[model samples]
Target: MNLKEQLMQDMKEAMKAKQSDRLGTIRQLRSAIKNKEIEARQELDDNGILGVISTAVKQRREAAQMYSDNGRPELAAKEDAELAVLQQYLPAQLSEAEVRDIVAAVIAETGATSMKDMGKVMPQVMAKTKGSADGKIVNQLVRELLAG
Candidate 1:
């Protein structure tokens, strides 16, 4: 089944198990997906769903960091819990070494010998690594590769 179908099934299971935390996270995700659909005026495919999930995960992570910085561990923990729930739907993340290797390959493929080539190389690398790697990590790797 597709991501949306999988999410719906999980939501149902959460309801049956009376998992309020899981249920709440799922409902929030569903709401976000619905909002995007309404705003974009189109049905979201798996990649589009993933984009929404990634955005939600990023928002929660930022919120958690902010809460922790403001001395609110309880609130931070809640955000962390929501992040974990959202993360389950994300594709497995690439390790640092793997990301570095991919960045190296992109650099080689694009002949990006200097930092100026970053813009040229990043889009190709991101296209290849989308959903499998984090953009920030990939960007850092690219900078290191170009700097070296």
Candidate 2:
């Protein structure tokens, strides 16, 4: 099944199982997807929906960290739960070592000799990694590889 279909099925399951947290997270995702569809004036494909899920995941991670740093464990736990729910829809994440290897390969492929080549290197790395890699991690790897 497609991602939207999968999400709908999962939502129904969550409801049936009486998982309030899971249900709420799914509803929020569905609402976000609907808003994006309205804004774009068309149905979002799997890629588009994945993009939305990625954004939600990023937001939740940031919120969780912020809450934790501010000494609000309860709020942080909520964000962590939401993050876990959002992550269920994402591709398996690349490990730091894997991302570093990719960055190295792209640098070699592009003949990127210095930090000045970051503009050329980053986009290609990001394109290759896509949903499997986190942007921040990819960026750090690129900078580390290019600089050294």
Candidate 3:
């Protein structure tokens, strides 16, 4: 099934199992997807849906970090839980080694000898990895590879 269909099925299962937290997270995700669709004035394909989910995951990670830093473990835990739920919808993440390999290939392909070539390299790397790898990690790896 597609991501949206999978999400709908999971939502129904959550409701039947009386999983309130899971249900709430799924509903929130659906709402966000709907909002994005409205904003774009078109139906989102899997890639677009992945973008929305990725943004939500990033927001939750930031919120969790902020809550933890501010001495709010309970809030942090809630955010973490939601993050875990959201992550279930994402494609399996690329390992650091896999990301590094892709970054290396991009750097080589782009002839990116210095950090100045970051702009040239980033898009290619991001395109190759699709939504499987985190952008920040890919950027960091590219920087490290190019700087040295």
Candidate 4:
């Protein structure tokens, strides 16, 4: 099943199982996806849906960090829980080695000889990683590889 269909199935299961927290998170995700579709005036394919989920995950991580820094562990824990739920829809994350290899390959393909070519390299790396790798990790790897 596609992501939207999978999410709807999970939502129904959450409701049937009386999983209030999971249900709420799934509903919020569905709402966000709907909003994105409306705003774009088009139905999102899997890649588009993944982009939305990625954005939500990033927001949750930032919110959780802010809550922790503000001494609000309860709120931070809630954000973490939601983040976990959202992450279930994402592809398996890339290992550090995998990300490094991909970044190196991208640099080679783009002929990026120095840090100056970061702009040219990053997009190709991101495309190859396909949301499996974190942007910060990929950027750091690219910089390290290119700097030397």
lDDT of 3: 0.94
User: Best candidate per TM-score, number?
Assistant: 3
Off by over 4 Å in 4: none
lDDT tens digits, residue span 1-148, model 3: 8999999999999999999999999999999999999999999999999999999998999999999999999999999999999999888999999999999988888888999999999999988887688888998999899999
- Tens-place lDDT per residue, model 2, 30-129, is 9999999999999999999998998898899899999999999999999999999989899999999999989999999999999999999999998888
Q: How much does each candidate deviate from the true structure in C-alpha RMSD?
A: 1.2, 1.1, 0.9, 1.0
| TM-score head-to-head 1 vs 2, winner | 2
* Ranking according to TM-score, highest score first: 3, 4, 2, 1
Better of 3 and 4 by TM-score: 3
Ten-residue stretch with the least lDDT total in model 4? 127-136
What is the C-alpha lDDT profile of model 1 across 1-148, one tens digit per residue?
9999999999999999999999999999999999999999999999989989988988998999999999999999999999999999999998999888888998888888999999988999888777777777888988999999
For residues 98-128, what per-residue lDDT tens digits would candidate 4 score against the true structure? Answer: 9999888888888999999999999999888
- For all candidates in order, the CA lDDT equals 0.92, 0.93, 0.94, 0.92
Query: Which residue pairs clash within candidate 1?
Result: none
Which lDDT value does model 3 have at 50? 95
Q: What TM-score should be assigned to candidate 3?
A: 0.96
TM-score of each: 0.93, 0.95, 0.96, 0.96
Candidate 1: worst 10 consecutive residues by lDDT? 127-136
